[model samples]
Target: MIALGVWQLQRKGEKEALLALYERNRAMSSLATYPELPPVPDELLFRKSSVVCLDPVRWDPRSGTDVKGRSGFRMIADCRTGAEGPGVLVDVGISDDFTPPAWTGGIVQGTVVPGPEQPTLVERLTGRAVAARPMLVADQPVAGLRQSAIPSGADVPNNHLAYAVQWFLFALAALTIYIFAVRRRLRQ
Candidate 1:
């Protein structure tokens, strides 16, 4: 448990560094370059860009919340950009419907955000290197949907310091109990 607490503290430091990177990069002006393919670097997150989605291949409905925290579904679409490399995943919009939105394809301006995690443990073990592509969160919603929440790095949690403190308290309590028990044993 004590080791676990220490590990969590280490993880907290790493998380803080990642958050710092997000804050620094997010503040920069929008990039002059827009990707034709994906696997965008973590450094590019939150920078505005325009994506011209030529063809929307598939739509994925994910349970998500709006900027106001209202419960809904985000319609993420796999787009065929007519580029040579991998296709892009664009978050079309949010809606109460689980069904795919009626949007076909168009140009949209939004921030470059992290994409969904992919390639499960089995895939990793199998050596399937399916890289998770970064997604474009559209600034405007599709005709029948609402704009999705602009994700922030603040959404990630860092409770490691608190966990370390709790572990230290537990160790102290155990030591105190042991000392008292030893004293009673000696008296008896």
Candidate 2:
């Protein structure tokens, strides 16, 4: 219980920091320069951009499901750049029923970067040589919408105080019961 209480307090602090960071990033102006991209650490995950095509290919086939729910294929496309520079990984969300063409065109709006195992999610799927797309490219999303993979869950759920109180109350009740039982035994 004590540990839970401490954890709850820590969670509160983290949630506050996350919200503050989000607000600050939301207020700042958007930039297209590479330097500007590195400085905005907070927006690095979701910063939007317009990218042209480099190559169209399949991505993330291992993470597939057959349940009666929404399904799609993960396709990768390199964002076109002015000079010979790094490309962003474009996650193309396709319906499970739909058959993706070998050469399709679209825009993606999420930062594609290297994971622990692979340079990009596409590489994780295809296992060929791949690099990460770290910027959010607004143009050329294969899914016809700007897709962002931000987690929508709340940062904090403050039920620890109540839980601590309940635990204390249970402890007190156990002690009272023990005392009452001893008194009754003595009287008998």
Candidate 3:
């Protein structure tokens, strides 16, 4: 149990460092250079950029939410830096209505975010696959909808310290119980 506690403490440090890196990335301004369609590194997760929408925007009703906790949906569509193949998915903005925006294909600016894991509930609700991973969080409003806030790593809770304390307490309780049992046996 002591060893487990120590491990959790180490994990806490790692999580803190990761959170700091995320903050730094979020603070950096949008990169003037956009990389070709490929795997983006962790360092570029929150980097901002402009992308031209190549395909029609599709709504992902499953993962939509507003800053005010209102029900909404994000517009998802394939986009590229220029006329090219292998465009990436972009999350345009959140809208309360289901109507598609008139500006379907155009240059949109936004920050990049890691694509969410496949949400089974969303897929079931929309009857379609969730938007591709590593989608963009648009900085501009679309179809009279407001842009959702880009998630910062700081919002992630670091509870490893609390977990470590719980483990140590459990070990201490077990040790006290054993000592009491030994004393009673000796007295008897």
Candidate 4:
């Protein structure tokens, strides 16, 4: 139990550091260009970036929240940056229409953010690593839609310290109870 508490403390420190790094990169005013797969820099997450999507393969309408926190549908464009490569997802905007729009493709300016998390069970099933893909949340809404929320690294949960405290409390309670039980046995 004590070891678990210590581990949570370590996790808290790591999460803080990651959030700091994300903020530092996002603070820059310069816009970064899209990189072709060779494993781009991890710092690219949460940074301002622009991508010229040559072709929008498909438009996915997903249930999401807008900038104003209104629950609705958001249009995600699955684009092929060039002739062929890894598809980059761009959250074009929020709309009431659950159906996809007629958007083809263009230069999309947005804040680079971490994409949706993939289920860990998928990686275990396939015996491979399946991580969240990087996505861009547009600074402006496309034609008829409204603005989608631009997320920050601070959005990541940081409750590890609180969890650590809970574990430590449990350990202390167990010890105290055991001591009382020993004293009662001696008296008997």
**Model 4 TM-score, 2 decimals:** 0.86
lDDT of each: 0.82, 0.44, 0.72, 0.82
Q: Which ten residues in a row have the lowest lDDT in candidate 3?
A: 54-63
Off by over 4 Å in 3: 32-39, 67-71, 78-87, 97-103, 118-132, 184-188
Q: Estimate each model's TM-score.
A: 0.78, 0.44, 0.72, 0.86
lDDT per residue (tens digit) for residues 1-188 in model 1: 67877887898898899889888877888878665445667788877887888888988889887778888999999888876666778888888988887777998788788787566888989898576678888888888988899887787677888888888788888889999999999999
lDDT, candidate 2, 8-45, per-residue tens: 66666666666565555444454454322222344443
Clashing pairs in 4: none
RMSD (Å) of each candidate, 1 decimal: 3.4, 8.9, 5.8, 2.6
Name the lDDT of candidate 4: 0.82
Residue range 94-176, candidate 4, lDDT tens digits: 98978776778888989887676444886868888556677888998888888998888878889999999999999999999
Segments in model 2 whose C-alpha atoms lie over 4 Å from true places: 23-28, 33-40, 61-87, 104-140, 143-188
| Candidate 1 clash pair list | none
Clashes of 4: 0
Highest lDDT, which number?
4
Worst 10 residues of 2 by lDDT: 146-155
State candidate 1's TM-score.
0.78
Better of 3 and 4 by lDDT: 4
